[model samples]
Target: HFGIVRFPQKKNIVFQELNYQYSFSDWIQWSMKIDSDQKTKEEYDKKIILFPEKKQIRQVDEPWFDMLLHKATIIGGEGRLGRNNVIFTLSLAYYSSGYALETCEYNMIEFNERLHEPLSSAELSKIVRSAYSGNYEAASREFIVELCQEWVAPELKNKDLFIQRKGWWKFKKPREQRKYSHKKEWKEDLVAYLSEKSYISKPYLTLSKKDLASELGMPKRTLDKVLKELKEEHKVFYKVTRGRNGGMVIASVKALFGTIIQVRKEMQQAYVAAITEKFGLTGSFVLNTFKQLAAPYKQPEEVRLFTVDTG
Candidate 1:
């Protein structure tokens, strides 16, 4: 008879359950661990099979299984996995008792599933602007890291520690060169960059700080600071319109426009690809694009952060 199996390790008093699909004998039977403790079991299992290679267990791909392993390694490891069963069980029970799922049809639930929501148009714009700012302290990395670290770290000590210990992403852009291109003019460059991305109706010939900086091998951080200084001096204007609060300063309009447009286009494309197959557009590309852009409306607070412009 087929039934769900709940395994309880001695020291790890918590119970780990899995739905087993039985086939003929043990040869074809398959089961997936639902808890994060699977990694612990796997390590132990791997060690057990060292003496007898023929007795090794079959490995299968499952999100839950991976999650379990991730948890075991991250959360617990008082020496070997099963060394302190009681502590493991207590920890598992304490953690699993609080488990809550938004949906039951679970297609491999992620740890941050509860926290993650789509970014709205305004929010996307803000993230882009912040990225342009190049100030790590003021960037959204703090909030993003906090949101993501909760599910993964058992005891995160500090933000810097998390950043250093955990994985972090970096932005890359090419160096700027000035001699070959048209002479740098703030107004002209800003207009050209925006027009290229269809942000503005017409392209002007002036060079923006961002664009010129790119052309002249200026560091992104240095460019952002210079743009801010220029904004204060009335040499550049930071413009913010409806919905998405993007910026175009007189000094760096060209580079800023390029960055914002590229980010929006990439985000839109990713959203489209993710949902297109599930909710078929009937091959209607226009309809699909509209649908993808319509998302990121779930959280207004989050959306507002992205929409706030320097202007």
Candidate 2:
């Protein structure tokens, strides 16, 4: 005969044979056997015990599971699932949801302590829905860092009601230092700083690397190393004049565009001269032909090519 065991508090149901000797602990083991891989099962077994003295559920190695159980206790009540049954219910929920371990760990940290005592069913459902739907693997590092900050160091003091016992706050202090080591982000910040300075001052003005390092709050050695790499990549240049203040200058986008326009103008003039010589046409005739060809794209103002008079 088949009998159904319903855990109303956990919203879980299990089917068992009435004729066989089946304890709730046996059901948990059986469920874990089917659902978890050997590695995960072994790890879970090492951390958690089915039944303990005074029925206190002890989670040893798995912080994620410990947090989950704590949140579950807050939501479902102390006696809803026994020490033996809670893991089984949560395990079933976890396996059925098909989230990776990394995803679960990160998302759990993000939504940590969001659910609390005197919980409403609607609020619980929303929290559960977010946990299930979250894609931590797809999330960017910046986004994860920001979320961690919000969890650990919220702006308003009143919002710090549910600070997690685990060291989430430990993350906030070292994040800026960690970002300095990241080459891509560091380069982008440097470029933005240079661009802002170039805009405020005249374009293509020489900037002191020492002053720039001081302004950016970075070491001169680090700035020099990054500048050397950027110079090799043609992203920046330095003017090696014999003076105390002479140093590197960031290339301006406006100056580059002006150079491009000047080159194009010179190329157009050469092409016109070549056509005049080939056709044995007069300079005026070739010039008129070029103007007719460009008539469709006539500019409102005359185009003046940029030039520096050395004389």
**Best-fitting candidate, scored by TM-score:** 2
> lDDT scores for all predictions?
0.34, 0.43
Query: Which predicted model would earn the best lDDT?
Result: 2
Model 1, 272-309: lDDT tens per residue? 34333432333355232332322211111233222322
Q: For candidate 2, which ten residues in a row score worst on lDDT?
A: 78-87
Flag regions of model 1 displaced more than 4 Å. Answer: 1-99, 102-162, 166-284, 299-311
The segments of candidate 2 whose C-alpha lies over 4 angstroms from its true place after superposition are: 1-181, 199-201, 242-245, 252-255, 258-311
Q: Following a full C-alpha superposition, what root-mean-square deviation does model 2 have from the true structure?
A: 26.8
Please report how far candidate 2 places residue 58 from its true position, in Å: 44
Task: Report per-prediction Cα RMSD to one decimal.
Answer: 26.3, 26.8
Evaluated against the true structure, the overall lDDT of model 2 is 0.43
